[model samples]
Target chain A: MANIKGAVVVNKERCKGCDLCVAACPCQVLALQPTEVNDKGYHYAFMQNPDACIGCASCGLVCPDGCITVYKVKL
Target chain B: MDINEIIKPENMVYTKPRLMNDNPMHYCPGCSHGVVHKLIAEVIDEMGIEEETIGIAPVGCAVFAYNYLDIDWIEAAHGRAPAIASAVKRLNPKKMVFTYQGDGDLAAIGTAETIHACNRGENIAIIFINNGIYGMTGGQMAPTTLEGMKTSTCPYGRNVALNGYPLRIAELVERVDGTCYVTRQSVHTPASIRKAKKAIRLAFENAMAGKGTSLVEIVSTCNSGWKMSPVKANKWMEENMFAKYPMGDLKNV
Candidate 1:
């Protein structure tokens, strides 16, 4: 299978740490980083495993705040 | 290749809808209102109707819906969105009009307005968000509260005998003579979100075509109101809520 790398950009300020994106990610590529807090004092979601993302946009789709953006590239 | 070069516009798959404002939403974390609001903005952007579109905001959690969408909006009295939207549509027949209402505002206090508007077949779209409980009022039991569902008001769980059965507004509206399209959807999953966006787009198109009243009920979740995590709330909604309010088209005339 061709390598399909994906990337996700999270607008940390906009994210309320709802973690809906973490649950919606099918590949388990997302996680709410506990160590880092954004300006909003929330532990926002991060792409813990970017290579595993399939660019499904599931995380972005379920996000209430429109905080996550997804991109893909064929390698 | 530079990382910046790879992150070009052509590589973008998904981003926030342009019609949505940059202001942070006041919705609770994991609240379905934000997702539904984004969908509405996307529909308006896709249809290029922002200029002619007028939204009627209800007096619920979505009362500030006007703040999120960059369009003309009128804050209607509680449950009076449909009545106001009807007037707007009648005065500006060429413009697109819609009402964003919650279960408490639509299925309860606005029940008569909702039914009469549909019965008259007003040329407007109604985006109904049915999260079962009244989230704005601290999760009180609503007209659409599921049987045996426990809310703040119904601490012992809703009893059909006293609270009455959960109103199936979509189905009821579908049966109305003037309704041209009616569908129940959700935004929990990607596929469901796509379907919902399609339904919303169709509702807008129907309104522009003057087909009749189009009602799209989004069976949503209230994680904070439900006293559960966002993830659990979605699962609970899928298992419990969907049973009473199945997702699909009730009518497409």
Candidate 2:
């Protein structure tokens, strides 16, 4: 079996920038933008290192705002 | 397929629950109530009971639960959610009724109604959020506050002599003979979130199966009220709160 890859779509507008998803990520793929803020003035989580994700969905699982959607691809 | 192509619905491993409305929640960043709300919406959608579920929104931070959830809801007076949920379940036997309450609402304001409804074996699920402080009203000491926890009301930590001990509401309700399922769970991490979601499913199932009362107490956190970041609040909960209100099933009959 080949390696599994993953991607995450963050609903920036709805994200409250709670940082739960950023901490829940196992691959260190997510982070809060230090200089950018959404319309709500919150620094929402974003996939800073998209290549490191392994489709674990850990970020999505712990997201309080339910703003992270996980997608997986099997090679 | 390219990673871009994997973003399609077929490759999606997880997304927001359908029952969760598109409205942005009003909860503060890292508020535990949002996770619980998401879990409830996921459970209701997975069970295919969106229309048959009626949520009783307690008068607290989660009073706007109806707006976030795409289901019917009833607003109850402060600490009166259990009584309202009992009536809703009794009147609509086929409906899956549940009350979303906070520590101040459940353990303090609605103590009598909660115990009596549970004692009477009302076929309704109760979702309790125990953050140990009144999050909505500016962080006042609640009935579930820890022994030495500081809040607006108890600025110098809770004094047992003046405020009495923190009530273990789950322990008290589990022994009431009316509750069929009683569990204390949290959503600080991925593993705990899954467990809490399962607990919610079980409680909802019990409510729909004509079983007795089921209470799922979520030992949550109020990052804004606690004066800590979301991550620090979760760590504090795991350290301070878990020792007092340990997670896992207190009673499952």
TM-score of every candidate relative to the true structure: 0.97, 0.98
B1-253: candidate 1 lDDT, tens digit per residue: 3335446678889989998989999999999999999999998888888899999999999999989989999999999999999999999999999999999999999999999999999999999999999999899999899999999999999999998999999989988899999999999988999999999999999999999999999999999889999889999999999999999999998
lDDT of 2 by residue, A1-75 (tens): 138889999999999888888888888999998999999899888989988888899988888888989999887
> Between which residue pairs do clashes occur in model 1?
none
Compared with the true structure, what per-residue lDDT tens digits does model 2 show for residues B1-253?
Answer: 4668778889999988888888888899889988899899999999999889999999999999999999999999999999999899889999999999999899998999999999999999999999999999999999899999999999999999999999999999999999999999999998999999999999999999988999999999998888999999999999999999999999998
Give the DockQ (2 decimals) of all models.
Answer: 0.78, 0.86
Provide the clashing-pair count of each candidate structure: 0, 0
List the pairs of residues colliding in candidate 2: none
Scored by lDDT, model 1 comes in at 0.92
**Root-mean-square deviation of every model:** 1.3, 1.1
After superposition, candidate 1 runs with Cα above 4 Å error: B1-5
